[model samples]
Target: MFDGIKILNADADIQKLMYSSVLDWNSVVNDGTGEVVGRTAEYNNLTLTIKEETSLVKVTGSLHKYANAGIHNADDFTPERLAGVLDSIQKLGIGINSALNNLEFGVNIETPFPPAKLLERLICHQRREFTRHVSKGFEYYQCEHERQFVVKIYDKGRQFGLRSNLLRFEIKVLTMQVLHKKGIGIYTLSDLLNQKLYPKIGNLLIQCFNEILFDEPTIDTTNLSKKDSDLLINGRNHKFWRPFSESNFETKQKYDTARKMRYRQEKRFRQMIDSSPTAERLHKLAAELIATKWEILSNPIVPLLHYTLNVEMGQSIIPTAKECPITGIDISDQKGSSRYLSERTLKSDPELLKSLPVTIGQQRRRKHHHPEEYYVAHNIRNAASNPRNSIKRRIERAVKNTPLFQADEVIRLTDEQKKILQSVPSNVPRNKKPR
Candidate 1:
C-alpha cells in the first residue's frame, strides 16, 4: 500500500500543457478495459494514460506536466500535498484527462447500520434530500452544477463506496505504486467535499444508525431518534469528522504535536495492558479493546511522498519481441528486458540511470545484410570515402607480418629490412626475427 510517491515535474513549456494539448499525440482509448494511453507525449518522452477499474481512475504518465502547469516551486510529494493538488486541478478546470477529471471520494466508515436502511433514514427524515434511488443504495441528486452526480453506498465491504463524478472538486490521490493499490493510488476528493458534503452525510448516517447490526443484536439494542440524532450531528464536538479529515499525511501535519503526544500515551497504555491484564469478562475486554482500536484505526498506515522519479527511471523497458513464423503479425516475447544496471545503480547513483534507457529506447532499424557482405561493403565504403582508417589497418598488418629488422643466417639482414630499420627514428626500437 502507499509505500512511495513520485512527483513528475514537466520538462516542456508549461503553456503547451494548458488543457488537452498533451492528449493530442498518438492516443488510444479502450472503453472495454477502461483505459486511455497516449504516446510522443511532448511533455515527457511517452504520453500518459488513465486506467479505470474498481470504479477508481488510476493515472499514469502526464502528471508531471500537469503538476508543473499548476504550481510554482514547492515540493508536493506527501499524501496531504498530493490530495490538495489533485483537488486544485479540478478547481482550476484543467482536468483534460477524462478518467481523472471526474471528481470522486472514498470513505471507510465503521458503522452498525446497513447501507439500505441508512439511506432510508437519511431520505425519510429529510436530514438531506436525494432526487431518486437508482439501484442498491445508489442514489442521485440534482447536482449544484449540471454534471453527472452520484451518491453511492457500497454493500460489499465495510460501508464504503468508490465512484466517479460524485463531487465537483479535486484531490488527486496517486500513491503511484507501480505494482499494487490497497491504500494506494489517488484516493481523495477536494477538501470542499470533505468540509461540506461528506461530513454532513456521514454525521447523518452514523447518528441515525443502531448500536449493532440488525442480524446480531445485543439484549439492550437501540437506535437513535431523529431529534436526538440531529442534535448530535449539529453539535460542536466532531468525533467522526476529525478522524476522517486527519487520515491523510497533509492534514496530519497540522496537528503534529498533538498526534505525537497521543502516540506516546497510547504506547504507554499498551505496555500497561500487557503487564496488568486480568480481563476474563466480556465487559473488561471490551473496555480495554475499544480505546486501543480507535487510536490505531484513526492513524493512516502509509505516509505518501511527492519525490520525483525521472521518466527513464520510473518506466520499464519493453521486452524483446519475436515475429511468428507464419502470420508475421503475431508477435511474442522471446527474451525479457534486462534492467539489472538501472535498478541497482538508481539508489546510490541517480545520474547513471539516464544513459541506458536513451540507448535502448531510441533504437533504429537499417537494411539487413549478411556478415561477409557488410564487412566488404563497409570496407568498400571506407576506402571510397576516406582511406585514413583503411590505410592505418593495412600498415599495422604489414608491420606485424614483416618487422623492420630480421635475423636470417648470422647477424645479416635483408636490404629492404635494413633500409626500413634505418628510416625509423633512432630512439624507436625495431623488432627483429628471434633466433
Candidate 2:
C-alpha cells in the first residue's frame, strides 16, 4: 500500500512519533504492554516486531519502519504533496548542523531559514489533498472516508493559501540577504513583483499554480488577488504606482512628454502615408525606416557613448556627449542627425532637440549626372535664398515645402548667365587699376 512513496531527510522525531502511534495500536491489540508479543527479532542492534489480534494489527521496528515505508514508496509521492515537507526537514537538519558547526568553529550562524518552509509544507499538504481523488481505490472508499479526505484536503489547501500569504510579508526580512548574495539592487524584489515586470518569474509562478489548481475560475481569481496582496507587501505597489502621485511632478512630466512624442511620431507617419496615393509602397518604406531605426537604437552604441562620456567627464556623474565619439563629429554630422540623440541627453537638454521630428528632404546634388540630381538641384535652388537654421530645421522646412521635382523640367539659363553663376576660381591674382 505504501508503494512509490518517498521519504527525504526523515527526522528521528517524526520516526519516533510514527512508531509511538503504531505501538499504541500494538498495545490495544496486546491488551497493553508486552502481554501479547507475536514476533520479535533484533539485527544490528535494531528491533523489528509485528503483533496481531482478532480485529487489529500493528508493526514496529527500531530501523524506522515509517522511513522504510516512505523510501520504498518514493514514486507514490507527488512533488505537489511532499516537496515542501521534504525541503523543510532537509533545511531544518542543515540549520541545526550549521548552528552546531558554528558553535564548534566559534563563528555565528549568519543566515537562518525563514518560515517560508512551513508555508511551503502547508501548500504541499493542500496539493496532496486536492490530488487525493486520483489515488488508487479512492472511489471505493466509504462515504465517511471520502468526506473526511475531501475535508482534510480542502482545509489543508485553505490553510496553505492563507499561510503562504506571509511570504510577501517576509520580503523585507529576506531582501538584504538576497541582495547581499545576488548583488541585486535593494528594490529588486519590488521590481520583480511589479506588473511592469510581468512575463518574467511572476507570470511563471502564476501559470504554474493555475495549471496545478485545474484552472478553476475561483482559484484563478483568488490567485490574482493573492498576487496583488503579495505585490503590495513586497513594495511593488510603490515601485509602479507611487510615481503617479502629485509630488512626483517631474516624473509625471517626463512620462507625459514621452507619450506625446510617441503619439506625434505615429501621427506624422500616418499623415505622410495619407498624403501619398501609393499607400502600400509608402507603408513598406515606413516599415523599413522604423525597423532600421529600431535596429540602430538596440545597438550597444548608447552604452558605449555613456562610457565615453563618463571617461571624458572624469566622474561618475551624468555622462553627456554632444558628438559622435567614434566618428569625432558633431551630433548633427549625419544627414538626419537631430533624431539620434541619446535618451539621457534628450532628458537633460534644455532645448529638447530630440523631441523635434525627423525630416527626410531631397538628396543633395552630385557633380556628375544622376537620376536624383535634378530633384536635389531644384531643392537647393529653392533653399539657396533662405538663411540656414540648424541642419535639422533646414531639412524639416525642405521636406514640408518641396514637391517631388521631375528631371526633365530644369529651366535653361542663358549661357552668359550660367557662365557668370558658375565662374571658376583662379590661383593668380587679376591685374587691376591702382585704387
lDDT of 2 by residue, 396-421 (tens): 54455555754223333222223223
Per-residue C-alpha lDDT of model 1 across residues 179-199, encoded as one tens digit per residue: 113221232222221211222
Pairs of residues clashing in candidate 2: 4-73, 4-74, 4-75, 4-76, 5-73, 5-74, 6-74
Give the CA lDDT, 0 to 100, for residue 271 in model 1: 34
Backbone clash tally for model 1? 13
lDDT of 2 at 155: 21
RMSD in angstroms, all models? 31.6, 30.9
List the global CA lDDT of all models. 0.29, 0.26
Highest TM-score: which candidate? 1
TM-score to true structure, per model: 0.22, 0.14
The list of candidate 2 runs beyond 4 A from truth reads 1-34, 40-49, 52-435
- Candidate 1, after superposition: displacement of residue 297 in Å? 8.8
Candidate 2, residue 18: Cα displacement in angstroms equals: 23
